[model samples]
Target: MWIDKLKDVSFDGRMMHNMSLASLSYLNIGGVAKVVCYPLHVEDLSNILNFCFCFNVPVLVLGNASNTLLSDAGWSGVVISLKHFLTKITVENDSIEILGDIRLEKLLAIASKNNIAGFEFLTAIPGVVMASINGNAGAEKCSISDLLMEYKYMDIQGCSHSVSKKDILCSYRKGPLQTFGIIYSACLKGEMSQKDLIQKSVKEKWEYRRNRQPISERSLGCVFKNATDYCAGQLIEHAGLKKKSVGDVAVSDIHANFFVNNGRGKSIDFLNLIEEVRYCVQNKFGVFLELEIKKVGD
Candidate 1:
């Protein structure tokens, strides 16, 4: 019935029935999802949200699925992805207004072209702008919140609100938009810098990540959040979890905190590996590692 009714809704985007979540995720490890919808713009997205809310159908909004671990059991309700559309960037003096669905790579490109500096640290970061902002994603003691001046979001009831950065609470790996239903757009401010310098910074950051992280592998980014005063990767390596495996998934040898899928890896195996790593790190370092990757379904 839900599927039938979903078809009746006026949607201005693509939809797939019984879509495989693995195809959408960076880890490439998840079961089928009942429905996956890619809404083009805010109006299309709002319509889908309202329909799901009215029918009491569960909803999950995914960006790039870079840091998400979807279950093998699959999602029962609608899964909304904004990666296909809603990508618009406007440069206004020293500020940039970005739509939620813009990919980090695209954002960085545009920023560089416009001589916007300060986001060089996000050179090779996966996922879209919304997901990055949601997790306050960054490295080298920098974060997306650094440039964020304001953001706009729509609640579950499809009502939109704009919020200033000064009024929001943002930390190392968390942002104030968690409770909000969906972030539609954001304004980020950056310093006006020389194009050559920005490009050089971006290249250096990208190379640094490429050498240290298992960027080419199928992974869900960092598996654990760093403990206070300790890096998560160092902790995991110190715990002797490097190359630890369950099924086809294993802790990346390059980065101990990253779990990479070799091939046909199951979500259950990934979960098991997490437990194993957590136990090892806890026992060895007396720190119970906290998960940084978001788990969904099952």
Candidate 2:
């Protein structure tokens, strides 16, 4: 069996069997995961990946779980979390080399300390560096891809590769690595500025998101990507679906695109609300909103 073969692999990091996905997801909603592994280093991850590949077991790689929704039916494959692994950051003269697991908050503090100006927009993101780069996490002006110089990723075969930013295909809320491979590290360039100026920018970015988003609530960030012609939040709000509810989940009145878990919300409730809002928005505007968040599991 695959389970038996997994025991023979050389893995040194943490492992949880039959773990609850709710504990890992930012939405705090989901059923159990068959197995979750946290690799200590690149080789450890490669080993796990190699094992999975050889056994033909499906695999899912996740960072902070901020931009993903884990289904209630649960994933039958191995879930690899880089949140506790590959978290290293080094600052050069005007650039930064960061690992996958580093959180945006920590990166922001470090960048500000180093007088880096361009990273202030990251204050609006609540995820780790790799996932942010994978999703091209961004604010009004720019995305994470704007700061990237080059990135390293491991393929499904456990082989590592690097690609320069000039070779990367990046767009709003999307990046090249989203479907290709697992990113482990990246080099990003930023402008040198006064520390106080950087701090001010960070604070302003934080304040903007704090006032606009339901920061204190449990959610999978924005539910729908903006349509070609209109903002998803504005459309949902115009449809009068703000504060719309399904079981314990409700669309945030503060930001109609975000559906918050009031308490004890299930993934099903979130999914139901998503459908209802999508139907309402489409019926009113004739636009079918695409999901911004990644949905995992059956």
lDDT of 1 by residue, 1-298 (tens): 7788988888989999999999889888888889998988888888888898889888887878898999999999989887776577789877999775788898889889999899888877887888788888987878999999999888776778889977878887886775747887999999999999999999998899999999999998888887669998999998888999999999999999999999989999999999998889888889888988989995
Please estimate how well model 2 matches the true structure, expressed as its whole-model Cα lDDT. Answer: 0.86
Task: Point out where model 2 deviates above 4 Å.
Answer: none
| lDDT, candidates in the order shown | 0.87, 0.86
Q: In candidate 1, which residue pairs clash?
A: none
Write model 2 residue lDDT over 53-126, tens digit each, in one string.
88888998887889888899988989998867857788998899987578888888888888888888778678
Which residue pairs show backbone clashes in model 2?
none
lDDT of 1: 0.87
Per-residue lDDT for 87 in model 1?
Answer: 76
Poorest 10 consecutive residues by lDDT, candidate 1 = 172-181
